[model samples]
Target: MRVRVDDASAGQRIDNFLVRVCKGVPKSHVYRILRSGEVRVNSRRVDQTYRLQLDDEVRIPPIRLAEKAAEPVVPFGKPFDIVFEDEALLVLDKPAGLAVHGGSGVSFGVIEQLRRQRPEAKFLELVHRLDRETSGLLIVAKKRSALTVLHDMMREGKVRKRYLTLVAGRWLNPMQHVKLALHKYLTEGGERRVSVNSEGKPAHSIVRLLKRWQSYSLVEVELKTGRTHQIRVHLSHLGFPLCGDDKYGDFSLNKQLEKQGFKRMFLHAAKLAFHHPLTDQLIELEAPLPPELERHVVQVEQTEEKEYG
Candidate 1:
């Protein structure tokens, strides 16, 4: 069967395009078709990496759908808070402890739930990502045109992302720039982890100290390069691991903070700004710190005063 790529589908990899259009097909089978040249773009056999263009004709071979037992039911997810919405985009205030999209043993996440709730939406895709434990503003694209434009803005350094985090140590620098090369590797347990290494992808984060207590500092982090665990790894390498960060954090401090009612990682995506993809209007959005995080900050302040007084 022939399928025509539209503006929204343009720029997506051929393999991803196939997976989305061909529901209930195993990923292994999708790659097999591509390798066998049964999947063609514009009458030419292209690799999975081919970025589809507008109006490109995709040839899909017949494939049997997985049996009902093979396809597990995706549980319904309650809708998250909507920070902003329009024809082209949706901004959500994602809470901590919810995965943005499910994979790696997670059954359902924000995107799946949103799609389930808005079954009539012709297109809905995550413009960017957030860690499962990180709470804050997240962007979802409603149109393919908007997704393409937003990606361009991010590449050109036009997107501004700011995060708030409380770390385990007193950060001495009022303003510090961290340019560390990071390498990702899986632990023996098969879990993903990143660390500072000489031979790795370059990463940058600008940290501005906001407040300090006896043993912790609240800081605002601006990402210059988006890398996996960039903020968490950078802070940890600098001896200021984020409070309650299970991975690359101070375990003793995390336990102490938990006992104090600070139960989750103290990292939050607080602000996002960019030019509207379709309108070219400057857009700035903010997600207020959740009550739990805000209250922890206040608790830290009270402790600081008590100690200094």
Candidate 2:
């Protein structure tokens, strides 16, 4: 079957378009067809990353949809806390412990729930991703054009993302810039991990000391280059892993912190600044620290004062 791409559909990766258009089809199957040259764009075989253009024709091969029993039942729930919203975009203060989108054992995620809530909405796509354990301001595009422009802005370093985190140990420097090369690899259990290696992609982060406690420091981190797990890996390599980070952290320390009422990763996306994709107007958004994190900070300060004084 042939599908014609329109302005609303343009700029989306072909694989994503297929996944939406061919509902009930497994993502793995969609990728397989692309790799096998069964899917074509404008009568030519195109890779999955090929962005659809206006008037481009997509050729889809016959495929069987997953049986009703095979599909997971994703329940609709309460909407996320909105930090900002307009016709072109949505900024949400995503809470920690919720995956951005469903996968990797998560049956439903923020995007899925949003889609369920706004079933009448035509276009909604994640502008970027955050780890399931990290909470902060997240952007979702309401239009395909917005998504494309926002992606370009990120690539051009025009978008600014700042995060707040608590790390083990006293960070001495008022501010320090970390530039590390990171390589991604899987462990024996097929779990994804990252390490500093010469062969890895270049990652950059600027960490500023915010406050210090007896054994931990709160920091503000700015990402110059967004690589997977960049902030966590960089801090870990510096011998100051993030507090409550289950992966790449001091496990014993995590347990101790859990006993102290800090059970979740102490990383939050606090601020985001960028130009509106369609309006060309500057936009800035922030999410306040969650109550639990705020309480943890107060406790840390009180503990430090009592110990030193």
User: Which candidate has the highest lDDT of all?
Assistant: 2
Lowest lDDT block of 10, candidate 2: 65-74
**Candidate 1 per-residue C-alpha lDDT over 200-301 given as tens digits, one digit per residue, 9 for 90 to 100:** 999889999998888789999999888999999999998999989999999998888889888899889999998899999888999999999999989988
How many pairs of residues collide in each model?
Answer: 1, 0
TM-score of each: 0.87, 0.86
User: Model 2, 1-309: lDDT tens per residue?
Assistant: 999998679888999999989988899999999999999999999999999999999999999864686757667876789999999899999999999998888998999889989998888889999999999999999999999899999898899999999999999999999999999999999999999998999999999999987688999999999899999999999999998999999999999998987899999999999999999999988899999999999988898889886
- Model 1 CA deviation exceeding 4 Å by range: 1-7, 10-15, 26-61, 66-70
Candidate 1 lDDT at 307 equals: 88
Candidate 2 residues lying further than 4 Å off, grouped into runs, are 1-7, 11-19, 25-68
The alpha-carbon deviation from the true structure for residue 135 of candidate 2, after best TM-score superposition, in angstroms, is: 0.5
**RMSD per model, one decimal:** 2.9, 3.6
User: Candidate 1, TM-score vs. the true structure?
Assistant: 0.87
